[model samples]
Target: MRLRIVVLFFVLAVGFVLAPRAAAQSPIVVVSQSLDMRFPRSMRFNIETKSNTRITVLRLTVWQNGVAVGARYSPAFAPSQHVRAGYNWSFQSLSEGGYLPPGTRGEYTWHIEDDAGNVHDTPRAAYAVEDRLHTWQTLSNDVVRVSWYEGDAAFGAAIFARALSAREFLAKQLNIQDIRPLQIFVYASKQDFFTALPPFSAEWTGGRMFPEYGVIMINFAPENSDWGMRATSHELSHAILHSKIRGTLGDLSVPHWLDEGLAVYNETSDHAPDDQFERMFQLAVLRNTLIPLRKLEQRFPADSEQAQLSYGESYSVVKFMIEKYGAEKFAALLNIYEKGAAPDDGLRQVYGMNQDELENAWRDEIGARSREISTARLPTLAPRPTFEVSSPLASPTVLPTASPAPTAEPTRIAQAANPAPDTAVPAPAPALPASGLCGGVVMLSGLVALSALKRRGGRDSER
Candidate 1:
C-alpha cells in the first residue's frame, strides 16, 4: 500500500507538469490559408479549417513588416464543423489615415475558436505591397535596391550607383555605422508616381520618402536622370538620418531646420554648391532679413519665396556648423536628439548654446550682424485710440471680428478639383501594443506623412 501510494503521487506530479501542453492541443485543424495581392486597391485573406466541433469565432490579424502591433478583424462566418472565412481589405480607406507604399511588406494570420472550446492559429504568411499595373526591372547591392519600369537596366544602374554614393557620403558625415536596407521605386511620370501615393497627396508632389519602410518614390523621366540622381541623394539622406534618430519611443523631434538643412546640404556627394539656395541665403544676409533659427525649429514659412529663404538659411547654417565644429560634434548632437532632447536642450547639451546663440554665431560667420529685435509699441500697449464724438448722434455699431479660414490639412492636401469618393468604413478592429520605427497610432495614421515637407520638390527635382 505504501509503494502504491508513492507511485500514484509520482504519476500525479508528472501529469501536472504536462497539463499546459495538453490544454494547448486542439481538435481544430487549419486546412489552408492564403492572401491575394490586388495592389493599390485591396488584398483578400482566405482561410479554410475543419474541426470536430462547430467553429464559433474566426479572427484575422494583419500588420506591416517591421511593426509589432497588428489590427485584428473578425470575419463573419456561420458556426459549423467545416468553416471558410474571407475578408477583402480595401486600400480606399488608406486615403483617410494610413498607407501601404509600393514595395512595403506585411504579414497576416488567422485565429479559430470552436464551440467545444478548441482553438487553433494559422501560421503567419507574408505579402509584398506592389504596383501590379507595371512590370518593374530591379537592380540591387548591399545598400539599396532600385526598381524602374520605363527605363532599361542601365537606367536602374545609374540610380543605384548614385544611391550607393549618397549612402557613403551620409554615413561618413553622420558617423552612421550600420544602415538598414532601402528600396527605391522610380516612376517615369508624375501621374504614375502620384498613383503610388495615397489619394490625397499634394498635386505638386514630385517625390516622397517613407522612412519607416525605407522606401523612396520619385517621378522623373529617363533623360532627366541627373535631376533624379540629386533627388535620390536628397531623399536617401533623409532616410539614413531618420534611421539614426528613430528609437523605440518613435522619432525624436529633430528641428525642421536641421532635418531639411542636412538633406539640402547633402544633395551632392562632392558637396557642390546649391546655387539657387545659396543665392537666396546671400540675399537674406544682405537684407539683414534672415529668419531666426528659433522660428524654423518647427516649420518653414508657407509662402514660396519665404520657404526658399528658409531652406537657403538652413543649408547655410548647417554647412557652417559642420565646417567649423567638425562632423563628430554634429553627429554627437544627433545622438543627443535621438535620446529625446528638445531642440534647444540638445544644442545646449552638445554645443553649449541654444538656437538664438547658434543663429547669431552662423550670422557672424557669414558676415551678417545679429538679427534685430523690434521695440515698436504693440496696438494693445497703446492707449485705446481716442474715439471721436461724431457718431454719438447715430450710435456707433461695432462689427464682430471675422473668424479665420480653416487651414489646409497638415500635409497630404488632395486636389479639390479631383476628389475621390467616400469609401465604406471598416468595423473597428482590435489593436495590439504598438511597436516599430513609428509607434502604434502614428504608424497607422500614415507614417509617410513625414514626406509632406518634401512634397513640393522645391526648385527643380529637389524632393
Candidate 2:
C-alpha cells in the first residue's frame, strides 16, 4: 500500500507539469474567404493575431490548384504578446500555372500552423476564369518600343501606326527624313502617366522639341484634352522644320509668328485658348489696333497683347488660304518654303498676290464682320475691360485700305508681291540702278576723254 501511494503521487506530479506544456502547444486557427472582383483587380491578405498569447512561430501556407505556391511567416513572438503580422504573399492569375481556363473553376486554400506543429486548414476559396486580351508590343527603336497597357491591341496598334505615318508625312514635307526616328509612348491610365509627366497646370506650359536627338515626349494626361493633340503636332512640326532648316540661312532665323502659325495650321485639334482669338479680334477691332495682314509680318502689338493678335491672325490667315487656295496649293506652298525658299517668295510664287493686297483683304473681312455683328441686335453688352496692348518691337505696317483680292485674272509681274508670314510689308527685291547702265558709266566716260586727248597729242608729235 505504501509503494502504490508513492507511485500514484509521482504520476500525478508528472501529469500536472505536462498539462500546461500540451495546452501551450495548441494549433493556431486561421479563417479566410475566397476573393471575388467584378473587374480585373488585385488583393492583399492581412494576417493578425487576435489573442494576447505570443505565438512563438506562426506560418501560413497557400495552395493554388492543389499545389503549394507561397508561404508567409511571423517574426519571433513572446508570451502574452500578439506577434508580428505579415502580407508578403501574392497570387496573380496571369502568373505561370496560376491561370485557370475560361468557364472553369479553381480552389485556393490556406493552412496555418503554430510552433507546436499543429495545423489548421482554411475553407476552400473559389475563383472563376475570365478572358483577357493579350497585350501587343511594337519596337519603336533599339531603346524604346510601344506596348498596349489596357486597350485592345488592334486599336492601340492603329493609333500608333497613324501617329507614325503622320510624323513621316510631315518629315517628308519638311524635307527632314534624316531626323532620328521618334518614339511614341502610350499609357492606359492617368495614374500610369503620372509617373512620367505631372498633371497639366496652366502655369506649367511649354514642351521640349529635340530634332537633333530624335525624341518627342507626349503626355496624354487629361486624355481628352485637344491640347494633347495640338501640343504633340506642334512639337513634331518643330522637329520636322528644324530638321529641314538646321544649317541653312545662317541660323535660319524663323520668326515666332511663322513657326507657331505653321504649327497651328498642321494641328488637327484646337487649343484651350482658342476662344481668346475671337476676344482679341473683337478688342482689336474696337481699339483700332487690328493689325492689317500686310503689316502683320513686320510688326506685332506689344508682347502679350500681340501674342493673342498674332495667333488669331495666323489661324485666320491659314484658314483663309486653305479655303481659298485649296489644300493642294497650300501643301505646295509649304513644300516650296521647306526647300530653303523665302516665305515671301514662296507665297508669291504660289499665290500671285503681294503682302499689301493680302493684308487689305484680311482687314476688310474683319471690319465687315464686325460691322455686321454691330448692326445685328447686340446682346446686353458687357463693359469691355481696357487692358494696355503690349507694344511690339517695331510698329506694325499699316494698310492703305481694306479691300478684297481682285477677281480679275492675275497679271504676270516681275516683283514679288507676297510678304513673309511674320512681316506685313513685302521684302524689297534686290535694288537696281535708276538707269540701265551700271554705276561706273561716269568713270568710263572720263577714261574715254583722257584716251582721246592722249591720241591727239601723239598725232601732234608725229606731225
Candidate 3:
C-alpha cells in the first residue's frame, strides 16, 4: 500500500507538470477582416496557429457561388517563434472581364495540419462577388477627370478626389477657371506603396512638380490617417494653386504666409473647431505671437510651439482679408498673380492698394477686434469714494494756518557739529605703499608663472 501510494503521488506530480505543456501546444485558430475590404477584388485572409508545434504542411480551400474555386495545400513551413504561423490567401478575379457576375457568393474553409498530426479547421468564412464598375466610379467634366478607387484600394484616392473637388469649387468661387487635372495614385499597403514611390522624410512637403513629366508628386503616405483631412486639403490646394497660376504667372512666387493661409482657408472642414486654421489662429492669439505677413514666406521657427503660432496667424490674416475685402478682391489678386505679376503689384492693380497698405489695414482691423474683445472681458471694479469730510475742529478761532514746512534738507550731522575742519578733513588720499606695489607685482608674477606652468603641462600632455 505504501509503494502504491508513492507511485500514485509520483503520477499526479508528472501529470500536473505535463498538463500545461500539452495545453500550450494545442492548436488555435483566429480570423480577421480588413476595415476597407470590398467585393470582387483580391481580399487577403490570414490563418495562424497558436501552438509551438511546427506545421510542416497546411491546406486552404475557398468556395464561391456554391462551387470550390481554389483548393490548394501549402508545402511544409517551419513553425515560427511565439508558436504562431500565418498564411495570406488572396483571391483573384475569375476572368479577364474585370467584373464579377451577380449571384456569385459563397464561403471558404481552411484546413490546417501540424507536423505532429494535430488537425485544425477554420470556422466557415464567406465572401460575395459584385460588379466592380458599379462599386467604383468617377465624375469628370470637359476640363478635368476625377475618379476614385473603392475596393480594397488605399484611401488616398478618395482624399485626392475630395481635394480636387474642393479646388474646383474654390476656383469657381474665385472665378479662376482653367484648373488642371491631377492624377492620383492609391496603393493597398505601405509596402506596396513605398515600392512604387520612394518614401518622403519631410514633415510637410509640397511643390513636387516634375518638369520632365509636367506632373506633381504629393505623397500622402505620412498623412494617411483618418484625421488627415486637412493635410489632404492642404496638398490638394498646392496642386490647384500651382496648376491655375503657375502656368500663366510664371512661378507666382507667393509668400509662404499667403500660400499657407490660402491652403489652410481651403482646408477648413465643418466637422470640428480643431481644423487647421482655427486651431492655429486660436493658439497664436492666446500666445500673443503672430508671424508678420511680409516675413511669413521666409523660414520661421519650425518647432511645434512656433509652428502652431505661425499657422494660427496665417489663417487669421487670410480670414481677416477675406472677411474685410471680400472674396472677389481676393480672387482678383490671384488672377493678377497668375499673370506673372508681383504680389505687391498685383494687390495695387486689383485692389487699388499696395501690399503694405493692405497688410496694415488687416493689422488695424485685427487690433481693433482684439481691443473690443479685451474690453468686453475686462473685470468689473468697485466704485470710488463718494463724499468729502469736514475737519474735526472745535472753536471757530481765526488761527493762522501754518504754511507747510519746507521740504527738509539731508544733513551729515554724524561727521561734525563744530569740530576742527582741518582735523576732520578727509584723511589724505592713502599713499600707495611700496608693499602694495610689490604685492601687485608679486600677484602678476604668480599669474605669469601659473600660465607658463599650464602651457608646459598642456605641451607635456600632448607629447
- The global C-alpha lDDT for each of the candidates, from Candidate 1 onward, is 0.65, 0.40, 0.42
lDDT of 3 by residue, 406-426 (tens): 112111112211222112221
Q: Could you tell me every candidate's TM-score relative to the true structure? A: 0.75, 0.38, 0.42
Name the weakest run of 10 consecutive residues (lDDT summed) in model 2. 434-443
Instruction: Score candidate 2 by lDDT.
Output: 0.40
Position 21, candidate 1: lDDT: 82
Once fitted onto the true fold, the runs of candidate 2 whose alpha carbons sit more than 4 angstroms away are: 1-180, 184-203, 219-224, 248-250, 253-255, 269-273, 282-288, 292-302, 364-463
Pick by TM-score: which candidate is best? Answer: 1
Instruction: Give the runs in model 3 whose Cα sits over 4 Å from its true position.
Output: 1-161, 187-193, 198-226, 248-250, 269-277, 367-463
| Highest lDDT model number | 1
lDDT of 2 by residue, 414-457 (tens): 21222122212212211111111111101122222322233222
- lDDT, candidate 1, 1-463, per-residue tens: 9999999999999999899888778989988887787767777889999999899888776766434345566777888999888988766563221466787676676778788877677666777787888988999865688999998888888899888877776555565545567889888877777677665765556577766556777778787776677777778887766655653235436887898788777777776655655677788888988899878877777555566677778888889888999877787776666656777777887789777788888888889988754556423221112121111111112211321121121111111221112222332322111111111001112212333224323222334
lDDT of 3: 0.42
What is the Cα-based TM-score of model 1? 0.75
The regions of model 1 sitting more than 4 angstroms off are 1-25, 94-98, 247-251, 372-462
Q: Residue 263, candidate 1: how far off, in angstroms?
A: 0.5
Q: Per TM-score, what order, best first? A: 1, 3, 2
